[model samples]
Target: MKKNGFKVFIVALMLLSLCFGTLGAQAAYEKTQPQTITVLGTTDIHGNVWGFSYENDKETTNTGMARIATYVEQVRAEQPNVILVDNGDTIQGNIMTDDLYNKREGAHPVMTAMNMLGYDSMTLGNHEFNFGENLITRLQALANFPILSANMSRHDGTMAALPYTIVERAGVKVGIIGLTNPNAPRWDGEKVDSFIYSPVGPACKKVVDIIKNKVDLIVVVAHVGMYPEYDEEFGSDGANKILELCPEIDALLVGHAHSTVSEIIGNTLVGGARNLGREVVRFDITLNTDRQVTSHAVSVIDMAGFEPSQALRSEPFIAKTHQETRDFISGGVTSADGTTSGGIFGKASVDFQPKNEIMGMPEGKLRDTAVMDLINAVQLANSGADVSAAALFSDSSDIPAGDINYGTIFGIYKYDNTLYRVPVTGAELKAYMEWSASCYNQAMPGDLTVSFNPEKPGYLYDMFSGVDYEIDLSKPVGQRIVNLMYKGKPLSDSQKLTLAVNNYRYSSALKAQKLVAATKEWESPNSIRDMLVQYIQENGTIYPKVDNNWKIIGVDFTSPYREQVVKLVNEGKLEVPYAKSLNVNQLKKDGILK
Candidate 1:
């Protein structure tokens, strides 16, 4: 009886040991299961904190920091491991940031909102330097998160900001390298003179080599687009160059071109969101127990679908600043001393631009208008240049017949660009005009209305004042500019002329494109926007007058089908032609406009 009892005890002990071993194996398997990590990114927020357009004096549903905040909160709640980042161009754009917050001393509204949103890190965009180095430093000090620029360095060779930051989530370390656009010096002019910029590709390679082994995943947040904005020989301003140099990058998020980008390049996941918080890029990365990225997916979420977060909008500083901005735009601001400023600064006699014949087409670009003329006149008057060039920045830009306020001025000229007077030979001027004329799509036979080139952004199509010229659509792009005259005489190729252009145009287009060999002779002390306000304030009332110095010729829109297409577009039955030119023939070919 004793032997049988002992045998039973041994059997029970063996079974218990087996059961414990099985449990341990199950725990090991669970630990090795793939874990998902999510990375959220916002780019080119451009000071839309309240998701409102101070220029239009209305609430914008499609964009703003508040909407981004709401979407981010939703993402954080759904995911166990999430990281938030901003790609840059956050500081200066509209009236609020450019006029109000950017000038003030304490916390910047954009930085304040970003801090509240819990941005992990931010890459420095070119526009961030618009207010100069001092403002950038103040903003950096105000930000709770790291402001990173690996490619930018001070004279002492130290990095301008943190090169990269590592964040750990779910035991997975992510190394995010921030690369600013090298062409910042070009666009920002002297604002970026204190710092030195190196090519993005080499700078990224160097950083990756140092941090690749230390982190489980390597991601790059670049303030550059996928393709080069200009010639690559000048400097690398695209993320594609970075990937070529650092193929080990697990993912890359880019901005600055303000276009939606989502694609997979080899093993790396690449994504970019649109400007002004219009979209958010989400990257989901799955990793194994060994911390190797197993799989990943990238998507761009539109902000229109998300509601603005009341919590973010109601944040003390944001709420107060938003109302103050609106007040400053409409009425004026009363200081602590009881002195009010910034309300009706000037007046306009009539609307600057005429109504467009075709929906979504900019008539101002097709011919000279008071809006462009006034901007050019301001540049010419301020700088004493013989000639001036400016662009109709937005299709909707116009000075309405009413009291002129800061918002009204902003509508006329959106960018905070300083005037630059440069000396250009008549040949160089012609070359520049030819380049600008290329913004129009080549008109073919049977085409009803003139259309702009989809690839050429409206900002690039500059119209010249102080010169008489015509863009002949019958001619090719290089030979489009004809009847070029200055001071009632044909402009000779050897004739020297002083050209007034914005600092941005001088650097990005004139110098970068090698279109002109001239150097800037003068720069305005104030922004062109400020000059416009001063001009209006001094004149009391401005009139809309077109000199008829320039016009588009050689294109015939006499087709009866043109009216039908325009009607359809205006009625919303047919979509506005943007991605490609939609003429009457094409519409009929598709059987859309019968």
Candidate 2:
């Protein structure tokens, strides 16, 4: 009996030891496990640092660096492993950046805000090169973090900037490669003369190959979008090509299309944030002791719920700059070019745009309006081109029947684009017109009103001055521009003319789309916005003058049902038809017409 009892006691002791050993082993493994690393990204901020619109002279709630800063701070407090980055288009937008900071010789406020936000790195967008190389170099010097572009190289064969950066958190190394859009040279003519841009895929692959062995994971921060913007066959400036070429890429953050994206392709995680600081793309990656990724998740956090960080707004230089910008728009400051802006630069005799028949539908694009005429007029006068094309950058853009300030001018023509005079044959011009006319959706039989194509942006629909044309919406897309006349005569296909256009349209639409095969003969020294300001200042008071040269025809809005739908949309009873065209059939399908 004593031997049996001792045997039982020894077995019980062995079991207890085994349990304790297992617990100790589990604790050791937990200690060796890597904590989840958080990567936060922003793109296309466009100089909205304080969440204020200098053009409207009002505070915006939904987007800004200040709001992003608040969210970033909260994340940092919650986790020790966090990295912040921007995907560029940061420096050039708004009157504050383009008119004031960009022309000065001091520290850029956007860079200052970014530095204060603790951005680890930023990829250069095409707009970053809008101002020229000197400004880009200055901005690069001012940023505490690296402003990278792997695809850009100097004419002398030197790298333009650091291609990639290594960020270590929780003993895990993350390799972030930055790629700028390869279309920079095409867009910023003569501005990027000293640099060479290679295809994004090959450039990214080269950088990934160089740093893959040195890091636990590979991430690409590219200024291009996930999909192709133009010329899908080129396939050089998209993130999908990078994914195809370098399958080892663990994650990618893309920009330049101002889109919201979150998806997983193969083994790689892809994410994109909306532009103007409206959202932040975040990735949480968990790695094991062997530095292999075990799990990963991505999310896009909207900044609408987040408060603007006072810490960012109150930064001394930023605060001072903000106040100065306000004062400049109010008409107290003189620009570097010796021009005093703001404080009633001119007067408008009437509202330039007619009221929209349907809410959210821009009447300016449906027909010729004085706003587009003013822009095209300025372009023609400055470039000496026989014909000029200009876009209504904003649907809400107008010259009110009152005083015109710098802000009003900015509202009309938002981008800081210069003028370009390019040669175009009659066939090329007609093709270009056809492309612009394609922004509208075909008017179906039951359609109550003409609607724009949901896939096409309003900025791509240009209005032509110095020509008379009729857009027959009843016809198919490529055949819509009928009765195209120049100087009261039908424009012949073999005629040749010079087209005055902004540099952006010249490159992005004419050259990039292969619609026109002509080089620019002349380029404006100042921005088109600057030229408008000069025109307004010199004229003192501008009158709304619509030549009625262009009109939209053949869309039947005669139905009483059309009137009912329009009334409903205007009275807030029906939602605006933005996703697709609104027609009687669709209304009946939705049970609204019935």
Candidate 3:
């Protein structure tokens, strides 16, 4: 009886103590003055550390981690309570970065720079898994900050990453929950096969449920950007959807679209930065004495003209590696002066100059272009596929006539997509062409230029080689391809042919998104970039000329905007054959047409 009475007393005493402790902590927190915190973030940095463009082998004014470092220092100096964060896609864009990445060595320059920047936390972008799960794990281990991704899980249902992390500052707890794009598995293919992605809305809700009561403030660092509506068919994981789904989230940082966004989405504060470390999105948050978020302001700090820190540049290890990369890119492989044989020594007796040709001409009227020809030639020689499909990655991509180096290689091919050979029926090939043709808007009388479908990205429009075809823009979307020919013979719908394409285009998950159909025949571990490099190394010189295989069938040449359109094309204002019509309107508004 005595023992039972003693046990009851102890339990009651413990409960009383816990209650008082909570009340005391709350009272003390309420008594303190409200603290203000500044949150600075960067997204989709894409391996830009030196403010350098490897394609052009020159420094650009817009990007670099060094500039971001200076900005971060400036922000920290002003606000002692500042916390730095990164939204993902940090690695794997530049040539130097790719060189190190392909090595799979522990020495990652991008991660090294991020650590130096002192990031608090980061989320995963789809591109982070491009090198595969193992490499991503290695990269994640290198980060001093917690890399968060709540939606991703192993096939066995174990969390691939932490859902949220709470950091305490000035007696207040701030919870940061991360959500990656749910469409990752579709785009990254086998690279993310072992993982499952949860719907972002549910994932955000799950994290919020776990962290809401524990923290004074909640910040969502999601790789998904803001979009008007949820695209279930395309698997879009937009910020607006999360804000709609989770009311407990206080602030949101978003990326993956590479769009500069800073605006209030309902009651939540949201923002994103441009690609390649060009700028940083800043959020200044104010809290009440009770530790509730009161007001938040957001802005973008452009990195242009921001000087890089000499200390960072002078870091011995990074400096040495960077210099080696520069040298490798600048060095000539094969020249007329009888340089050491890298491949086919001096195959072209004369220097190969890439002619700047207008892209996106309507079918039947399409002219052969040096750009498409060069890419097609490389694909044909490497894949040996009967037909090759290639896209114009960039309108400005060009290789000078005098010399070609690693820089030129990246210039021509911006992505590190692996080569794929897929068996496709002639009907499917035509359907693919039709899908590619959808990239361009129909030519209208008032339309000053051949504009692109604003809904589609430029990289989706593919130009083909090893086959001759005509595209009629006047026809309906699915009926664009006509007069298609293979080896000077009319292509029949039932005929089967091997087509060379990139892994991104051939991805089963991506094919559904793109509405392309094909049967995979073979895939190579070899990257198209490496293939191009090897081809150049073998053939000492490249002679790029178009076969005039594809043409645009119908364009209203008599349109009132003809002269102005021609002028724009000549001046290179029409960089993308299919640009948004807004671009045309802008030119007219600028009086460039008059």
Q: Candidate order by TM-score, highest to lowest? A: 2, 1, 3
TM-score of every candidate relative to the true structure: 0.89, 0.90, 0.85
Model 3, position 308: C-alpha lDDT score:
82
**Per-residue lDDT value at 278 in model 3:** 91
lDDT ranking, best first: 2, 1, 3
| Candidate 2 lDDT over residue span 20-109, tens digit each | 998888666654887688999999999999999887789998999999999999999998889898898999888889888887887988
For all candidates in order, the CA lDDT equals 0.86, 0.88, 0.75
What are the per-model C-alpha RMSD values against the true structure?
Answer: 7.9, 9.5, 7.9
- lDDT, candidate 2, equals 0.88
Runs in model 1 lying further than 4 Å from the true structure:
1-33, 232-235, 334-341, 559-561, 571-575, 582-594
lDDT of 1 by residue, 1-594 (tens): 899999999999999999989878866675577778899988998888889988767899899999999999998999978999999899888877877777778877788889999989999988888888988799789989899999999999887899999997766788999988888877776778899988888899999999999998888999988877764664487788888889999999989989899999999999999899999999999998877778899999999998899999999988988888888777667532343335887888989899987778778877888999888888889999888999988888999898888888888788878889999999999999999999988777766667788768899989999999988887888999999999999999999999999989998789878899978988888789878888888899999878989988876667777777778778888776653455666776888867
Name the lDDT of candidate 3: 0.75
TM-score of 1: 0.89
Name the best candidate (by TM-score): 2
Residue-pair clashes per prediction, in order, are 0, 0, 17
